[model samples]
Target: MTDTALTSEATHGVALSDVAADKVRSLLEQEGRDDLRLRVAVQPGGCSGLIYQLYFDERLLEGDATRDFDGVEVVVDPMSAPYLDGASIDFEDSIQKQGFTIDNPNASGSCACGDSFH
Candidate 1:
């Protein structure tokens, strides 16, 4: 079976697209986390329904997934994994939009501000 079929803390549960992974790697490197992985979480907030939290963490939670990328690792909580299942976390740098955006298939609908989802 492919590595994607494996289920464990070594996998993010949700797949990280090439763009997303590249962006995340850049951020991690900038943050000086050669030994750190990107942690994606969903918190209560945003206009749509939920807000995405991206940070660097070296510690793993009780029920979290730890996936190793080219050289970086990705950490995701079980609770957040479902919401982020099949979601793509990307970073943009455009005149109109510049930041991390979560393209989540689980989000049935999103708010105008693009912060919350339902």
Candidate 2:
């Protein structure tokens, strides 16, 4: 996977694995649109007080930091950058579980559902 930075001064806030990058690239290709980017953010109101949000976004908001894995772009907004910093994202397709997972070092605790963190 390519590790090229979008900008010299703009470093990636979070880590995106090769598997996750492939999955994201495939999904984006299926959508047939090159305008969308994979956005990762942390928001309030989960069982553990915070939850992760991952989706494709067409707009680039202010203070958005981006990193390119191959051709796929991963974005993190300013507010969510600190919360997601040093976090690694991966995709699993095993029979046991099928989805993207986040490994965050900053989380002190997480809920039972494994969907939120404190």
Candidate 3:
């Protein structure tokens, strides 16, 4: 595992692993878009009541907090910031699994499928 570094703004926000940032950069490059940012938000729903939403966003809403990992920018909304603070996002690529995974310290418990958290 590579050592993940957090920016001053990211210390109280989300941390993006180097691998994940690289992946995001590659994905954006493939799409040929430099205006989008990786948005991480928590929405109400799912088995555990709260589910994570990660996607590319071009619009920057009010009160959005951003952190840069390498050249990749990650944005978290004010409403979801508390739940995602201290969370680390990493990417894994292997025969067993392949995707971005969030490790949140704020989650008390998560669903069996690991898609949501309380």
Candidate 4:
């Protein structure tokens, strides 16, 4: 597939939806550190062979791609960038599901738990 992440304004490998960015902003506000960035990365050893790692980080590493949405920022490492290209992150708050979800167009398959992908 094409690397839309590289071509578009979202060089961070993935795009964060408005709701997700807002939630992140809210969380950072709760923590009283709006300077922290949401770091997104890919890791191995999941049931689907690949897993996503997301968290707030204050440090910047080498070869990282960063994107900002309103007041929230997202950072992706070089290695994870290619794998997560064309991916989009969203937040959900409902009785059935309440958390962040990723919509990755490059993933061929995903685990039943929805925490891993291949």
The TM-score, computed over Cα atoms with residue i paired to residue i, of candidate 1 is 0.78
C-alpha lDDT of residue 56 in model 3: 99
The positional error of residue 64 in candidate 1, measured at the CA in angstroms, is 0.4
lDDT of 2 by residue, 1-118 (tens): 1223333236566989999999998998899988999999999978999999999998776567888888888988878989999999999999899999999999999999899999
Model 1, which residues run further than 4 Å from truth? Answer: 1-10
Local error of candidate 1 at 24, Å?
A: 2.5
Quick one: best TM-score, which candidate?
2
Candidate 3 residue spans exceeding 4 A from truth: 1-12
Model 4, residue 19: C-alpha shift (Å): 0.6
For residues 16-112, write the lDDT of model 4, one tens digit per residue.
9999998998899899996698999999969999999999998766567888788787889889999988899999999999999999998999999
A best-first ranking of the candidates according to their lDDT comes to 3, 2, 4, 1
Q: In lDDT terms, how accurate is model 2?
A: 0.88
Predicted candidate 1 versus true structure: per-residue lDDT over 1-118, tens digit per residue: 3433343425655566677778878877778667676888998888766888888777665667776656657788878877887887667779998887878888999888888788
Query: Which TM-score value belongs to model 3?
Result: 0.89
What is each predicted model's overall lDDT from 0 to 1? Answer: 0.75, 0.88, 0.88, 0.87
lDDT score at residue 9, model 4, on the 0-100 scale = 42
RMSD values for the candidates in order, in angstroms, are 4.6, 4.6, 6.9, 5.7
Model 4: CA > 4 A from native: 1-10
Clash pairs, model 2 backbone: none
1 or 4, which is superior by TM-score? 4
